[model samples]
Target: MYRVSLFPTRDLHLSDLRVALINYICAKQTGKHLIVRVEDGDKAHNIDGKDQELLDIIALFGISYSHLYYQSDNFKYHLQFASTLLDRKKAFICFCPDEKATPYDGRCEHLSPDEVLNNPNPFVIRMKTEPISDSFVIMARNKYPTYTFACAFDDMLQGVSTIIQDEAYLENSSKEELIRHAIGYDQAISYTHLPTVHESEKSVQWLLDQGYMPEAIANYLLLLSTPTPTEIFTLEEALSWFDIATISKDSVHFDMEKLGFINREHIKKLSDMELSKRIGYACENIGKLAKLYTKEVSTTLEIKQKIDVIFAKKEPLATFEAESKLLQELIFNAPYFEMFDEFQAYLLEKSNLHDEAFFKPLHFWLSGSVQGLELALMYPLIKNYLKEIVR
Candidate 1:
């Protein structure tokens, strides 16, 4: 059993998705139950409808939870456990007025229960910590339990066996462990703190806006932790190779270059029809371009731009002078090949002149770009562009 907490702040980011994905993978591979807990106990920071938005985001990534819970739902139990500590003389009510005080001095530790009940002042509950240790406050005067108290109590009550979180929370593990011991819970939940994703200037929304695929994002995230030899892979293939023990403890830096490379690889995997559908979502012209090229394109904008180049009213670039003879020959033998196989045989017959030097200028004239789809596939598109230009 594992429990992962998501705060569902108003401005959600990629880091939230990264944490959720790691936890989901861990639970799935280990055959353990996973609970997604919305940490809404701190109502002061909670936003309206943010919880449902968080759920929507989780579903967007195709992650599923065995159980869903809200920390606020167990508020009564949190307070009860804090009170239990008081009854067992493990904690006391501090009447101190200073809000900035740290390592509480236990000023009200000697106050009797009757005195605490009768003398009601704005007070906070402080754990009666031992010497060589600083006292910590678990509940404020407003009766709202601190994050540490609520998290620990609920983890125990909910039978959570493992806790997965970012490295920033490693400091709080000790505080939570103390609360667990104070509450008389013997079994300690295993802690696994995954390395944090270095803060990126580009937010998650920005990446999506730039036409990145979700699969590529997930693949890039996994590659940051695991040493996958290949640039592209499906989530199922990645899960088969995922091992929590192999995750690097050092923080992972977000590399946009690597992400773009992975995205290109994923784009290449899509069938032409599927690629057209995705392009159509962006622009119908791009979808028609996909049908014209009959090959994979890295982005919708790329295909659209290529189509514009082919349909430009201006003549092809003057740089095609070196291939002028080849161009005239291809035009004169206009209907040389109706099928790609016949074209390949024709190229094989002129193997000596079919090298990169011969093809490079031809590609430049046809696509306005030096690099593009294979000649076998691009032949038809180039012929069509030539016919339009001649007319």
Candidate 2:
């Protein structure tokens, strides 16, 4: 069985996605159970519903798990393991002030039992670690099990054969192993530590809101500074070609430009009706308009921004302010025409505004830009809603 831990201290980051994806792939390939350990024991730092939110994001990526466990739910088991260590003289009670002692300082390791019981100050439990693994706090003064203690015992009790975690937890992982060995639960386990994506601190939902598609985000995470048979693929499609051994040991940085390109490619895959509905419209013409704008922009939000300007009230260029006013009245009373050329010719002759004078304000009135898709290409799709587009 493979396990992944999700901490609710913050929204799931790109590194988290990497962890989830790798675990899912490995478990699926081997036909073993995958478990999700929600490390939400730190109530003070946890965000309400963030644990569920992280799971939702993982689900969106199509990762499957056999069981879900909350670290807090196994509170009793964690305490039992902590006490066993204490009874064996492998751990001790420390009366150090909460803010006074740093991790693994061993300041109170020598305290006698009488001195410990006589002390009235709040105390935390610290493990007496071997030289290879540094000592650490097992249980806090609040009676809550520290992450290392809770996670170590849970993994041992639950039969997790493999753990995939970010490199940031490298030291903590070794300490968890130390605790397990100290407690005499010595079943062999495999650990795979992944490098963090240097600049991906935003939550998964943040990326979605910024208009990056889930497929695109998955594609990027799987291939960032790594080799891939192809540049773009769905999460499921990567399963066949994805090899766990190919993961890089060094960290990689996020590249917004490459992701933008991937996002654009995914956008192109959406149906016209789907595209229309995504930007608050249902008409196919609106969909077509959005797709046309895709050549110039990379995200759904960017496409909508360009499409929205056509329906918004006009904002003419200052250089063509006079031409704008003249063209506005000419367009309001102009006869309906099926083509941009026909409508344009009528305005050109009626306003007697030649070349730049005729076209610049006309461009702004219709699309709110002096430079954009040729008016000829845009006019037909929008002609039915010309009045709405120009005003």
Candidate 3:
């Protein structure tokens, strides 16, 4: 049974979501168990309601966990485990000042427990690390277990066979291992260190506020994890293709352009009715416009704005020599046909001008750009615009 952990400390951010997603995908694909552990061992920094917010965000991404645990709940176990290490002489209480900036130097390693108890100074229990090792000593201060101590103890207690953590926690692996060895736990918990999601620029919430969809963010994150050329895929598709060995060790930078491209692709896949529902308004001609203009838009508001722009009259840049004749022909023939196809045929037959020159100016006048929805889809809107202006 593989057990993965999602450890959110404080307010969840894009980096936290990224870690949760990577672990969730791995555990789901392997048909293993996923555990969500709120690492609130540090009571000083723990914020109320942030834990629920993290859970809500996880649900927003459709990720589920088999078990939910909090490091703070196992305080007794952690303290008892620390006491065991102390009893075995593998750990010592440090009498260093609480405000000291220097690292613990095993100053109290030789002090007896009676001496430690007799001392009036507040002290912290520090694990005696191996000599000539880069691993830092694990500390438990004021009944609060350090990250390394709590994590190792909880993983063993919960039977976590696998630990997926951020690469920033890579250094703590040795400390955890030493704790496990001191505790005489034989089974080794496999560790997968994922690269950090760089948030030095814009944060995830900022992107969401800017109209980026959750689907786009997830797809972009999956692309960053592996070297696969496939850009657009659903979470289920990503799960089937996810392989832990294939994950890149190098840090992944955020790409806003790629996210926009993915969001546009998703927007194109929505049905006209679905688009209108998201747009939060209806127009007599919005259904047709939604299908026609969605390819160029990323958000529902953008679609609505584009539709409004299309309906609103735009002043012509320069009156063409053939403009008077074209407008007269359109006014006379537009009422004869209800469908755009027939109207288009009528315009072709009546106008002596070339198709590109005759239509390009009108297209530019209506949309202020030549590149937009096909004129056939814009026919009704264009006719309405022309009628108001011609009067």
- Per residue, candidate 2 scores C-alpha lDDT tens digits across 272-291 of 88989988889888888888
- Using all chains and alpha carbons, the TM-scores for the candidates as numbered come to 0.73, 0.89, 0.75
| TM-score result, candidate 2 | 0.89
Which candidate has the highest TM-score of all?
Answer: 2
Alpha carbon lDDT of each predicted model: 0.71, 0.84, 0.70
Error of 1 at 338 (Å): 8.0
Better candidate by TM-score, 1 or 2:
2
Report how far residue 310 has shifted in candidate 1, in Å. Answer: 9.8
Residue 9 CA error for candidate 3 (Å)? Answer: 4.9
lDDT of 1 by residue, 261-351 (tens): 7777776676655665765534333344465442554544555566666445434335555454455355435565767667646644553
List the candidate numbers ranked by TM-score, top first. Answer: 2, 3, 1
Residue ranges of candidate 2 with Cα displaced over 4 Å:
98-107, 315-322, 329-338
Off by over 4 Å in 1: 98-100, 118-120, 281-391
lDDT of 3 by residue, 112-161 (tens): 76897799987777777655223244564476788888888888898888
TM-score of 3: 0.75
**Backbone clash count, each prediction separately:** 0, 0, 0
TM-score of 1: 0.73
